[model samples]
Target: MSPGASPWVLASPDVREETAMHDHRRIGRELDLFDTDPLIGAGLPYWLPDGGAVRHALEEYIRTAERRAGYRHVYSPVLGKRELYEISGHWSHYSDDMFPPMDVGGEQVVLRPSLCPHHALIYRSRSHSYRELPLRMAELGGMYRSELSGVLGGLTRVRAIQLNDAHIFCTLDQVTDEAHAALEMIGRAYEALGIAPSRHRLSLPGPGGKYVAAPGMWERATALLTDVLDRSGLPYEAAEGEAAFYGPKIDIQVADGAGRESTLSTVQIDFHQPEQFDLHYIGADGVKHRPVMVHRSIIGSVERAVAHLIEAHGGAFPAWLAPVQVAVLPVSDAESEHAEAFARRCREQDLRAEVAEAERGSLGARIRQARLVPYQAVIGPKEAVDGEVALRLRDGRRPDPLPVGEALARIGVLVSSHSTALWDDGDGA
Candidate 1:
């Protein structure tokens, strides 16, 4: 195993290969992705082995994509000083959803309900130049919410959330383009995860004391986000009072197997936070000017994303993200040696593969157990002698026998490309 890798990496914890369409709660239990304990309270669930692997893969993927897109990653504490939220106006405008403040050593702190306040402080850490206008900072960090017990069914509504969050501090002129790019990033991430947006939402301010009182800022922020959606030609609904306490946002919504919808990703134009935090960048004229803070999330939260994946794909994740990508089944104990060797070869290629244990009953039973795996490589006496293997795909396509090397190559292609296609004509299935 790689350094710092989870001990669960070796086991990968096998799950049923095929799943019927069900809500994430059912699939999460059946697939060993996550579970909740009454002692730990509602809205807090712990990830199991298989679930952790999927979440880790997603975090790494988003990290890589963010780096390629010029986002500087950062780490921030889940707990923030009570004064921080007060300064950012969360205490006034959004305290209802926050946990009660804790007094430690005469200092009050609370689990952060959002990352923007902390990120705003980071932006204010030092003087920045106009050339550094669009400083994009990202984090796969934890935030907490005080969700009601009734609303906390599964990962979808959680008290502790691992958010794929970022903030881009850009000049006024850069706001529209940055928001547009952010929306596109969310779209690309959905495509890679085999996810589809149910609809796009322009979440605008409505009648509320929760929203910032600045009407001009609200109008400008709404228009900027509206321009992004309009230019993209993607149809969207303007949801009143759905905007953040600070600004208007573009919410990318996804529906579960049960037809329930939730926001999976978001891009917001925040002029409120910069002014609240007194964030500024020196302009070409050497005068200090406020920088707009653009808030965005690609895959909102790992827990919720996994929940959606469990339902959307029916637990048959894409090869790259699947808990168990390959299951090598030996015809009998006679071919178990070849099965183990093939499994080792797959592991060397960094693919998640496992050899079926002989104690799991007959070869037919083992194959049946592995039906949810994206690819099943079957080894038998004849194939062992011929140095080839039969392939069974999750989509029920069995290609002609091929050398193990060729099979591995094709599997690697699909996994690395993050393609949704199960088979290609080139594979000759």
Candidate 2:
């Protein structure tokens, strides 16, 4: 096997029969990661305990990364007045994919299909100087899509989405630098998450498509994104009619186990929204100037991102991302207290550790049950007496036993550093 590749593979056979299984859907069910019910209806799935844990880890990771990149996080409502969508151009150009509007005491409010309009309102709420340009705002916000019943399946194509959305308001001259920085952030995030984007496409508005009438605006935005892709030295293609109705964008695509490609992350440059919302900042000359809206998502949506991670890693998540990083198992009831204490210690250290129920069956059975866990700590009579742990990795490697503290420290380092290796024992760390 390739170095550090997981052995606990989830079955991802392609659809051939009516009962054929998809990778994440099958494993998610078996592991209780997520579920679907007739009551909740199709296209809307609720995450079980394990799935919620995984999503929490991913959300925390994204928030930290965004904060480090100088993005200020915000909370925005999921519903917006119909006029907001109109000003953002979603109503005129892309209303088909949006949910119907609702009348609340005479005001028509719609479930926001996107977060840009509200963010634009936030920017317009206050005046800014040129020095405050390139203001980065981010949110892990919920949005809805009016997807057809035939198209909805699993976490990938869902009606409701928790998007990792961000918009950078910057001066025109800073567009290239901002776009470059956004792509770099995406690269670092993808590397840490083990996502290999299949391709990068420059999505442009094609003929006979609804788009902003400003040809100059389209030209500038596409050229700027093209330059960003050029300087990054990444291969990309141009796809017609794939750009947002407002402007052009860079779409990072990923393929599923079935060989179907879908957009994973995106970096879009829009010059139209500033004018539509009349958003501006004061220049050094004390004159008002328009700011560019650079929209990008490190991981487009929590659902789609998790779906890809499940497929990519085959449900054997890395230590940091695993729902349960370590499973503590005792050989018999004698070591139950010791095992529970060890698990508690792990929890105190911010590590996700759980003691497997002994009565569930034999040691072999419990081990098989937690086969996807990154690390397993087995405490037998000798281990309990000596305060040591028999460390077994999910990859089927068993090393010599070590003191409880030392074993915990090793796993702590791996999880905190997001290292894919089972244990870093040297300078390789």
Candidate 3:
């Protein structure tokens, strides 16, 4: 067996079954969501169609949310010059976690470990006034870190990560409000995904000089975040030395179905990067001033979020987020054409639907397999002739038959609104 292969694969059937039920790796394989290949190197995953769909949906959801919250999305390159990191202080303190620099045309460049530095450069690309004070720049950018091989797990600890990263540039006076806004966004995102944040951590600097900001700056920034959390009536514990190399931050910890807490969202108050990049904006007095940088992410990493979602929902995704939201299963070969037509109709309504062809299994077996989908539309002769479908929900609830048009309308509403509920009873199905 491969060194990384699961030992459960060699165990008894019962043992394997019990353990594999909650294993994201096994569930990902069974659902054909993603895969890793030795030839492609460890810690790098290739998203299959199903996994790609889930990631795409998540990206769209976050982009829309950020946009509505006044965030402007931007694309930045993954690789940067060595001088860039040196100026940003990443080379001095964070180089150990970053990949080795490559010599390209006698100049050293490396993959970015985070998107904050790139966004800082973008902010400096333009001259702005205080009117643009709360400038929110967002990106769903990919990053690479030199994580240890032993620490790399399925999606949770991959070397490559696509971050839902953003930075808010504002005056020091606006720090508290921006941080509060970030927290509100985080809460909305978690509620939409049906994941509850267990606790919050006000990560502060330690006694050492590992942090880039001066002691006074660190204290001020930490105080600002603390006041924001307190005023918002949030309960959070202070964790000394848990601050990032650059600044203090608020970490939102969420628990998965397995009850393991992971930090998936964060809001960091950065006072050092602006100094490193010399980022500035003109105030109403017509003088240059440095803007405080608020680094935040609602969903820190898309890969890890999907991994958590897989376990949180036991591979049964919500209707809007599921790769294949509906499966049309025909009762027999005679109803195959109708099933295909019904699936196509669902597709026309913007639903991810597929027809489960009855080729190698009985109707009962096919229905059982189709039940894995969030919604299953069974097409028998009578239902097919009447243009109606018997809906079997993933939760084992069988709603009454409804016309195909009405069913498609209800599904559209469920998807468009991003509802976590299986299906609404108001549909009168």
Candidate 4:
């Protein structure tokens, strides 16, 4: 075997079968990630303990990265008066995707379909000088949309979702640079998670889409973004009709096991919303000027990203992201005390580890159970007596043999750093 071929290698057919698009629903359950309840309605998911843990970790991870990139967290209400969408041109273009308004106090109120309209309202609620040009407002806001039942699948398609959504408001001149920074930050996020950047396509769309208020402005915006992607050495493809009604976008596409591409993220440029909302900032000359807006979602939707991660990792997540990172098994009653101590140490380090007491069944059976849950570390007397623990990998059967302290330390570092060593195929193998 190659010195560092992933410890979790599977037969080529197994990899293909596991990643196939049709297998995601089954894998979600097998991973103990999430489930759907018919009574709760279609296109919605109920996350179990492990699934919820994964979502929380993802939120913390993205939030930290956003803050480091200078994004300010903002919260917006889940429902809004019907007028907000009108002012943002969403009513004219995307009204079909929005939940129908309900009668409340003789006024129409609808669940929010997107965060941009709210962000625009926030911008208009304040008067700004040029210094406040690039106002980066980010939110993990829950949104509701009227999606077709047939299209919903697990977390990939949902009526209700908490989106890692953000909008960047910048002057025309600052647009390119701010955009570059955001894209680079997003790329880094995927990298840390062991997601291969090359798997995605950066897509640009044409100007003729409906409700695109100004063709000239659209052309200019798309050109600027095209230049940005080129300068960054990013490869992209153009899709004629994929642009949003108000602006053009860069669609991040990924392929499933069957090799079919699906959009994973979106970065859009808009020169129209500012005009529609009458948004402005005072320029150096003290005259009012509209700030350009870029609507971006690194992972698009939390639900969708979760689905992709499940399929990509084939239910065996990395240490940092795994719900149960380690499981300890004592060889017999005599080793139970030592096993408990080991599990406690792992917990103290913020690692998710559990101790399994001496059981009635065989060791092989116990081992199978451990593998079923797929722990990152599996410890027993064999390991304890040898002063080592068996490090289980999602993709491998043979655990790493290492001293207890050393194993814990290594796994701790990996989890803490959210490391994914799998992506480091330097030889391009």
In TM-score terms, which candidate is top? 2
Q: Which stretches of candidate 3 lie over 4 Å from their true place?
A: 1-20, 427-429
lDDT of 3 by residue, 1-429 (tens): 221223223556774565468678879988999999999888998899999999999999999999999999999999999999999988998899999999999999999999989999999999999998899999999999899999888998899999999999999899999999999999888878877777898887777767784878888898899899998898888877778998889998765544456779999999999998999999999999999999999999998899888877878887889999998888889999999999989888888898888885887887777666889898888998898999998888887999999988888888888888888887633
Put down candidate 4 lDDT per residue, 121-157, tens digits, no spaces.
8888989999876899999999998999887877777
Provide the lDDT at 218 for model 2.
93
At residue 374, candidate 4 shows an lDDT of: 43
Reference-based lDDT, residue 34, model 1? 89
* TM per candidate: 0.93, 0.94, 0.93, 0.87
lDDT of 3: 0.87
Candidate 1 structure quality by residue, lDDT tens digits, 139-168: 999999998888887898999999999999
Candidate 2 weakest lDDT stretch, 10 residues: 1-10
Clashes of 2: 0
| Clashes (candidate 4) | 2
Winning model by lDDT: 2
- Cα error of candidate 4 at position 8, Å: 30
